[model samples]
Target: MVIATGTLLLALPVASETGQPVKIVDALFTATSATCVTGLITVDTPTTYSLFGEIVIMALIQTGGLGFMTLSTLVALLLGKRITLKERLVMQEALNQLTVEGVVRLSRYVLFFTFLTEGLGALLLGLRFSRDMPPGQAFYFGVFHAVSAFCNAGFSLFSANLMDYRGDLLVNLVITALIILGGLGFSVVADVYTKRSWQRLSLHSKIVIRTTMWLIIIGTLMFLALEYTNSKSLAPLPLGEKVLASYFQAVTPRTAGFNTLNIGDLRPVTLLLIIILMFIGASPGSTGGGIKTSTFTTIAVAVWSIIQGKCDIEIFGRRLPRGTVLKALAVASVSLLLVVTVTGIMLVTEQEEMEIILFEVVSAFGTVGLSAGLTPQLTVAGKLLITATMYSGRVGPLTLAFAIAQRLGRQGIKHYPEEGVIIG
Candidate 1:
């Protein structure tokens, strides 16, 4: 569904002011980048694409961020049609619903919650934007950015992204709010809305909430402390501005590409911190992509258990299932391998600094979109590689692997014994 939608959008006829056709490769690349929410672009989006093209791209980003199934389900509900059991099952899987019976209700809630939060975010952003832009343009910019931030789509009309508004408290707060809500998995958000308390939350919600808070707090402090004296970026800012910038940067890296400062100017330690946050990405069943906060938490718990010589992994005073722990480890391992391989390929194909290339590659694979200014100079091969990385990041490496596994195997009763080799 994603590939088809992206391809069709790319194939749509777009022309310059003189009626010349836009290059097909550029269209394809941009379509893939936006639909996958990777944010790597060969050409500057605001300058290269016509207004119509920009709208089309934005629509695609929203659709892709909200899964095709979810959008179709909403349309079905709007048309007053009853969804079938089979359809509900698919929707349940697509939205990662806990059960099949509540699929319709869950879908409705998801849609409502998404729009409500986005609307509020847009209003706040628009109020701030009016200080610099006309009311009409400000409103549109606010709506566009709200949608983009919540979707984790990373598409921006501003050439420098949110850097110009770094010190604007209203803009920073609005964008950060959108990013946080988007990064929290839909399931967690739904739980919050329905339950309204930490005690009443599901185990998944508990894990996501704790993991997200920890990452943000630790990440912000690390960036601030590491980059405080770096002359290129953070040093010159006033203390208050530096704190705001640090927090914004910390929040943006978790699978939302909007930047408040020059990424290329960041100190190495800050870059490393950002990379870690990007690798963690957003939670499951959300607009953002990564191994997910729950997965990260599960892995951490498992590691802690092993280090403490305990057998079972426990968190929030509850023991996680063995299968869950294993799955988390598997996803993390696969994601790491994908990032390393893609980074190596980019190094060979693009003559850029190691930090920049690594940042680009990891950002692409994590769907974080925090580039170090190396995106525009990528070769054709490099672009294609990134396109693939973005797709995998969005769909998930483990999910794709499972799809391939199903094709290669039937029900199997045979098992191979596992063996341990070397210690770390």
Candidate 2:
């Protein structure tokens, strides 16, 4: 519904640079990308959209990134209306909480954290941008990019999309810091804020923190090694810029989608590595999207336990519930199937190479907007396919399935005696 409304608004003549309504396909594509917080663009944002259009897009990105439920809750609070049980249930599902306990308080925290963080980012970025442009324009740019980065929505007002700022330390540091904070789920941030001790944090927070750190470290090292000598990417830069670019590229694939390096110029191996990182995306209850860090870590822990011939999956001194393990595996399986099916369809319908098509499809599915220069040239069918993927990725495969099942009426569990199948 939000995307539909955004589509209608963007299709207005007031939203375009030439005082004409954008084509329906283009409007819908842009709306989906912004509302899903995916940075993919069929039209160059700065060149195609007027100031009014840019403001609309930024609004959509903020609404999409913080999520519909979170905003609605804030509105309800402002209205002094009580949150009924039904609303609490909806909030629970929207925030990916395990229960309804403290959901309202959490919503308050979400709004507070979001505004405070975005404000700080905007101040820093605005001060930096003021050096390059007039104060008013600098402030606007700072606010737009700060919201975009904090929401993990990579939409940029600049035509080159931060490529010109690749060597600017302040820009890189501020943007990456916002991306990391946004990708680290709000619940984790709240936990850290309140507890301020690693040992006192919840098990989920521990796993998410550990997994995110390891992925960033590994991705940075791998990117540096693989693209270190590739002239098109990292080789021409001085050692410091190369390292900076490596870190930026590494972090962006975790569903932030801002790129300081040309994504198309990377080697096949480097691209494949990025695919893996995008697939495992941000943690749950965060602005970003993907299968999620918790999901990936749960699956890995389960596999490790099996390999060790252990009966239980244990992490951070707590044994995971059987249902948690099952849900994690289910999410991964469904995500893989969705990615494979979408990639296959694109390959059949589009004239692009296998690698390019696969990359685009994964980018859509992960809501990680880095493209191999394929987004703007997509055919109508390709655009529609990607739009649907962005929506699905943002909502999550399992959540979509659950919604469908509920619409069709819930089915009761029916268990039968198990018979072992042949082992691999």
Using TM-score as the measure, which candidate wins?
Answer: 2
Q: Give the residue spans of candidate 1 off by over 4 A.
A: 1-19, 398-422
Give candidate 2's error at residue 286 in angstroms. 0.5
Model 1 C-alpha lDDT per residue in residues 23-138, reported as the tens digit of each score: 66667777777787767777777777666677777777788778888899999988999899999988877886557878788788889988998899889888888988899888
For residues 121-195, what per-residue lDDT tens digits would candidate 2 score against the true structure? 999999999999999999899999999999998899998889999999999999999999999999999999999
Listed in order, each prediction's TM-score against the native is 0.93, 0.97
* Model 2: lowest-lDDT 10 consecutive positions: 401-410
Candidate 1 C-alpha error for residue 247, in Å: 0.2
RMSD of 2: 2.1
Error of 1 at 200 (Å): 1.5
Superposing all C-alpha atoms, what RMSD in Å does each candidate have to the true structure?
A: 2.6, 2.1
Return the TM-score for candidate 1, rounded to 2 decimals: 0.93
